[model samples]
Target: MSKSNFIKVIVAGFLITSIVGCGTKNFKKTPLDNYIVENSNEKQFSVILEDMDVDGTFFKTYSHKYRVIKHKEDDTPYEQISDWIEVDKKFFAKHEDNLGMVILEKKGQGKISKVASPPGYGYVGDSRYGEWRTHNGSTFWGFYGRYMFMNQMFGMINRPIYRNDYDTYRGGGYYGSRNYYGPKKGGSSRYGTNSQQTRKEKPNFFRRRASKSGWSSSRSRSGSRSRSTGFGK
Candidate 1:
């Protein structure tokens, strides 16, 4: 190969590499998001935005919970569990409105989606976990006999998963970097904090801390729910 051609090739490669690197740097995941990606070993896992306290730019921290519903590769749905973590301002801006919703979910390590999803939406339509059924011409999602307990765990007894809505969530860019609430109607979604069916799930530390005045979130921390009368009480 000629020296001029080789030089041109190297220059082209360098520019491409630099461009790709810059793009990667633009998409920064919060520590909570990173935790789900690095830790979950099940076939599917997700993170929920439970609550937050933002007192100006100086002290802003959001609390979150995560659960891996599946056990290994099996169809059995594990008992849903969640743990809380604090996030910075950047994470706050990205997921505040979607509080009490799944801000991130992973399917077999393929994609760690940031698009806000409804609670239990991660496992609702997956064929391995549940299936579609029709009742008087209206179709809805129902888990198998063994997984029936999840129906209450996810608060879906009154609100059934309709086929049309489920397909939209799984198919296209329904919300695109925004939280997705089912149905176009004015009413709030069933899972997010905005709805009456579901309440903000927070750990005791923040719950007790919530009542105190002037809180700041300069760093991140994780905690579990406490039996004591905390935030909700």
Candidate 2:
């Protein structure tokens, strides 16, 4: 072959090799990239347990789902700037940590309010307690109760409070209206009527046992129901 032809061939081969290498590099995926693709529709926020002062405690590391109320673009990929509310107003946070650069902000827009303890049931001073079902169909009591206690102890009253009148469903066969103290009076409570319809139409994520991480399980109260004449009929 002529010298000129040999030089052209070498240059052509190098260009092809470079093009293939760039394509392969662009197609490579990282763990974070895979996670974001898998959970594209999900809006997850992570917080360092140590920063919350509950790192070494039983509530060290946990994951809870929250409905994104509002957010804005920043240096990080996505930051929950405005306050966000949990289902039933059970928990709330003013802001969330940067979920790294892989996550994208959810499409829906809304506002979240802080949860408040039911009236007359002070976290630091009162003895009365209650339980409520979260949006994920998991029953959360002590975890959030402890969170409230810790916040109050440190004078972080701006955190959130639980509302006694907030609508929630009870597990098992029985369903009814739950007040600050317990089930409300009168046979036909709003919750009971609503729950009966909900149970038939909606299926929930129920766990048979507590998680190994020390999170309480709803199964503990699986048999705590007492038959009532009002809602069942």
Candidate 3:
């Protein structure tokens, strides 16, 4: 083959490979849109917490009890589990409005405690704030005496329904993940001996800085744990 032709073929191959394989950093799951139709009125969705007991000796998995139901219709939709995964304390400080709604957050190893409420009583005005209250005003999730382990499930219709605000608003929150990634429609702290309210109200150790359309990293350190309590409760 001619040298020019070989170079052109190689460039084309590289472009194709990049286009097909490139994916988001720190994430391994697919987008929710692929499974669920954004605004489909056909199916109903719900999320339940799988109760688990870790006796420090061995960990046994339990079925999820409460569920955050999205749609109540008979038909069931498909959605990504991660789309519903949320990290509470970390999420609220960055996106306060997201409170009372289900959302997802990313955390490093041992940082699973990322899901916690803002101290005592969970919510200030509404007890339902930190706890998961069903659409029917019933206890759904949250309120684990020890460590709470649960999963958020997303649902959508199979029809080719038009996408909604979530799908369009792609990473619109503190986590910089897809806006629809969490509760779409709706949308931590160090430990200490201080009071729950006082501690939760305190500022987070890591502060987000201005971005310049590029990549960056952040780091912070603190001594205590359990300063705030939500999904981790």
Candidate 4:
């Protein structure tokens, strides 16, 4: 073939290869994708995953718990507590309101704690400004984020909790607790004093069991219950 004709043929082959490559490219979903799919049924709920280093932000992984406060017209102020899940260097969350109107604040202290109230004694208020009462007439500060609320609602679903001797099982699934993805290296757990670890070391067996027990059907039932409960207590 002539040189010019050969050049044209080569160009055509290159174009075809490029097109095929682009068409067959696979897109890998991140952990954020899984989180969204898990909580997709939540109405008016959204997610924002960002790197803590962006713009000198302080929303670092395990360093802060995000408070999402929703303000509605002629309605009671709604608030939710969000704990960021770190995948690599980015933080992931499932928020309950409009990202713009919501007030995003960090809870005091880098860690989360539990405050139990005495029997017959109600209203355990924290020093924080956002005060709310549970159905049991117990007052507590901070809103329970989507994951946190679900973790509590479903009898401590499948999360890990830290204790005196070592880590133990809890009613709630992993959310803002120290036992979600195991310990991390070079960083302290917000919930406990455990050193760095990985998810493989502490697998979320609850999730595996749920899947084996037909999680799809159970999830549907659980979603209905969650909607009815309305995040109270």
Candidate 5:
């Protein structure tokens, strides 16, 4: 082959090899790593776990799903951000050194009042304790936040908390109803009907009627007669 032709062949081979190598690297990633790389550019806020005073095992199981959310109206600070976090016990112990840092970050958007706590991120007086807000895109939810009771390992623990002027100032419209924050009395429900009861008591008569109508006409006739007779007619 001519010198120029040989050089061109070599260049073509290099290009093909580079493309194949890149594709191979991407295909070899774990499912989780592939997801992170694919969606890393999503718009969302960041949350840093400053200090954690929990045991190494606890820290390992601690899921990091926190966010820095701004109030809707006045742009003040609400309790929790929004995100999903899951950390098991062994996972926590295994990654103790990686604690006190941003662990799990989620994406999405929407103005939710509270960030939902994972299995073990709740506390007594926590207004934004149990439930979480919904949003589009993706957002982060740190594993540890203010509600946890670790010593001073991390140095800071700023979980969600309602301000004194929360009730007064209505700047941000991102506030959940009174029922949203928490129950009236401390840990228990103060009102006559709690959300759980309301949901349970709330029946779908429409669905029930449809189900009953599905019975054979003969069965339906018997049911009507039985109801009318009070016993067996």
Candidate 6:
């Protein structure tokens, strides 16, 4: 080969390698178990994954926003707190799809639970928090006077938790295992990273970084088992 042609080929290969390497990163996951164990003293509580952010630098790291929810008693209002936990690329990838979902919950001195679900669903069929109601013959969830705060807190004011949506979520048995967002009928689900309601809760995370990373596009990818789980699937 001519020297000039050989030099051009070598340059092309070098550029391709650089592009690929730029996207590759090695990150050690900060185990979610650690987070759960940190708060095990609470009798009833939930740890929610609210948002995810990737830092822009030569070496990228991640920051995860979490909301820890607790209700001291059946009649009392829930107490909620939020904080940011910095994590690595590997841990980020595992939970990036679960933004605005519950990652851990313990009820009434029960064991720490790692089943994932959209927030406020545990109250759907329970009579303590709410009861079923009808609007022009259409059924929906109606929170009691004291539990009214959940309507907005759970993103149900605009989204409106219809009976069918909750039934489908439960019928699919997605309550404790798979991360569910509305339903998976008609070849699509009504809620997820794209839902306006979800977007409202998760902030403008994907919208701000849509073009650069295609984070939304890659959300369909399955996640690996949680580090906190030891039970067989």
**Pairs of residues clashing in candidate 2:** 115-160, 115-161, 116-161, 116-162, 117-161, 117-162
- lDDT tens per residue, model 1, 70-142: 4544556554445545544455555545655767677654566778777677777577667999999988899
User: Clashes in model 1: which pairs?
Assistant: none
The regions of model 4 sitting more than 4 angstroms off are 1-26, 48-77, 88-233
After superposition, the stretches of candidate 6 with alpha carbons farther than 4 Å from their true spots are: 1-31, 73-75, 108-112, 184-188, 200-203, 211-233
Q: How many residue pairs clash in model 5?
A: 32
* 4 against 6, candidate with superior TM-score: 6
Worst 10 residues of 3 by lDDT: 215-224
Candidate 6 residues 17-117, lDDT tens each? 98878766533335466755665676666667767776453445466777666765554546455555666555676676677777777765375557677
Clashes of each: 0, 6, 18, 12, 32, 0
Per-residue alpha-carbon lDDT of candidate 2 for residues 50-90, written as tens digits (9 for 90 to 100): 11100113222222222211212431122222222111111
Evaluate all candidate structures by whole-model CA lDDT and list the values in order.
Answer: 0.60, 0.27, 0.26, 0.29, 0.31, 0.65
Better candidate by TM-score, 2 or 4: 4
Cα shift from native, residue 142, model 6 (Å): 1.4
Give the clash total for candidate 2.
6
TM-score of each: 0.64, 0.19, 0.25, 0.20, 0.22, 0.68
Query: Best lDDT goes to which candidate?
Result: 6
User: Distance from true position, residue 124, model 4, in Å?
Assistant: 33
Task: Give lDDT tens digits, candidate 3, residues 194-219.
Answer: 22322233233112112211101101
How far off is model 4, as Cα RMSD? 17.6
Prediction 5 TM-score vs. true: 0.22
Model 1 lDDT vs. the true structure? 0.60
lDDT of 4 by residue, 123-205 (tens): 11322222343445533333245224422221122322223112122233322432232234466542221222212222452
